[model samples]
Each structure stands twice: as structure tokens, then as C-alpha cells.
Target: MMGKTLVLVTGMVTLLSACTMMDQPKSLAFRHNAVTADPQAAGTAQVTTRPDGMVTTTLVLTGLTPGKTYAAHYHAFGPDSSTDPCASNGPVSVGFPSFTADASGRATTSVSSEMARIAGDLGAYINVHYADDLKVVPVCAPIKMTKG
Candidate 1:
């Protein structure tokens, strides 16, 4: 009888532990694309999990004018026709990086650690510069990530 009780108790403890662990939030993989009005200019981004519970993203922009500079950030929403969605949520702009185009009009950069923690209703995109301001752009809002 004692052995049976011990086995049942052990099983119950094990089950409870498993349930607790399952409740934890999971790491995620995120991806997005940049589509500009100028079909010749567009980009794609892929983010992977890192060991430190952060995400590292690799972005590639193609069909751009070579030797140009681009200012990139994770915006608040996908392609909004009206205003910059990120302007109101200043926190979203933290840890963004700037990338310069190569002779082939391709650029690459990684998203910063702070930016990786952004959750729920967030999007990412790149803006291609024409003059001092952004001329053509591609935006992906409501970025999705996978949970484990």
C-alpha cells in the first residue's frame, strides 16, 4: 500500500511540473517583407531565436538604387496610408539600426535586442530614401512570431 501511494504521489508531482513548464511563454521566429510602390525595390527580413532569449534578424533589400542609405525600424503597424504608426509609440523605435545600400542596391542588418521583446500588434519594415526624406517604402505590420 505504501509503495502504491508513493508511485501515485510521484506521478502527480511529475504531471504538475510538466503543466507548469508548459505554461511558460515560448521563443519565436519572425519574418516580414518590404514592398514598395516601385516594384523594382523591395526587401525581405527573417528573424531567428538566439541563445540569450533574444531574436536576431537578417534583412535583405533588393532592386534599390545602389549606394544609398536606408533608415530601418520596427514600426507599429503594417503599411498605413495615413501617418507613421510608430511615431505615437516611441518605445518601438528603440534599438533600430541603419543600413546602407551596396552597389547592387542590396542592404542587410540585424534587429536589436530591445526590439525583439516587442509583443502584440507590432510590425517591421524598411524605408528607402530618395532625398533627405523617405521617398519609396515597404512596410509589414502586425508581425507574427512562432511560440514553442
Candidate 2:
């Protein structure tokens, strides 16, 4: 019994160590949508690729209108502009769950998507919009900087 317990413990530790040793993904920074600036909006997007190749992205935000509803999505390179993915007016590739800012003007939301959905030029950027009025965008995080 002691020998069996020792092996089980060692296996658990090895599994945990392997998980921690996995590569850390780089975070995508959100910037004020220059075309339609929201002086008080900022955030970061982090994408993590799982062992099976599915990717999950979490968006962490600050400086939004308190209690307001917002929507966000991963977008493909649009027809508007090639150089700036954020300004390209892309179509939604994957949408995150709608979220609302807290009393402190901060929010966090996440979405899990298949790697193929956001691969290459398909997932060019992520944009945050007002849930009540989609025309208003406060921040954008560029993923694929250049579109081919």
C-alpha cells in the first residue's frame, strides 16, 4: 500500500509540473479606437492554446462607463483598410459573452474558440462595442497586425 501511494503521488506531481511547463502565450494589448476614441477605455486580451489546439481568449478591461452593457468579438480583416486591422471594419469571427462594467469601470469576459476560426488573417482583431448601440466602439485589440 505504501509503495502504491508513493507512485500515485509522484505521478500527480509530474502531471502538474508538465502542465506548468507549457508555453505561456503572449497577451494582446487593447488600444483606444483612434477612429472613434473613448478617452477612458483600455484593456488587454490573452489567448491561451490548450493541449488539444483549442484557444481561449480572455479580455480584461478598465475605464468603461460604469454599469453599461458591452459586446466584443474577434473579427476578420475587413475591406476598409489593410494596414490597420482595427480600422478595417471586419466581420465577426467569434463573439465573446456580453458583459457589463462594474461600478469601478472595469470588466472581464472570455470566450473559447477553435484555433481554425481565428487563424491567420481570419482573426485580425478584437473590438468592443456598446451593447445598446453597436456603432460606438471604445477599444480594439489587434491580433494579426497585417493582412494579406
Q: Over the stretch 1-148, how does candidate 1's per-residue lDDT look in tens digits?
A: 9999999999999998876654354332222234444356655656554445565656667765677766655644444332444223322433446677788877777674543455443443233344345533543332432211
Worst 10 residues of 2 by lDDT: 17-26
lDDT of each: 0.50, 0.90
Alpha-carbon lDDT of model 1 = 0.50
Choose the strongest candidate by lDDT: 2
User: Which sections of candidate 2 miss by over 4 Å?
Assistant: 1-23, 35-37
Q: Assess the local accuracy of residue 75 in candidate 1 as a C-alpha lDDT between 0 and 100.
A: 48
lDDT of 1 at 106: 77
lDDT tens string, model 2, 1-148?
A: 9999999999999998877655466699999975553578998998888888789899999999899999999999999999999999999999999999999999999999999999898899999999999888999999988886
| Candidate 1 error regions (>4 Å) | 1-38, 78-95, 124-131, 138-148
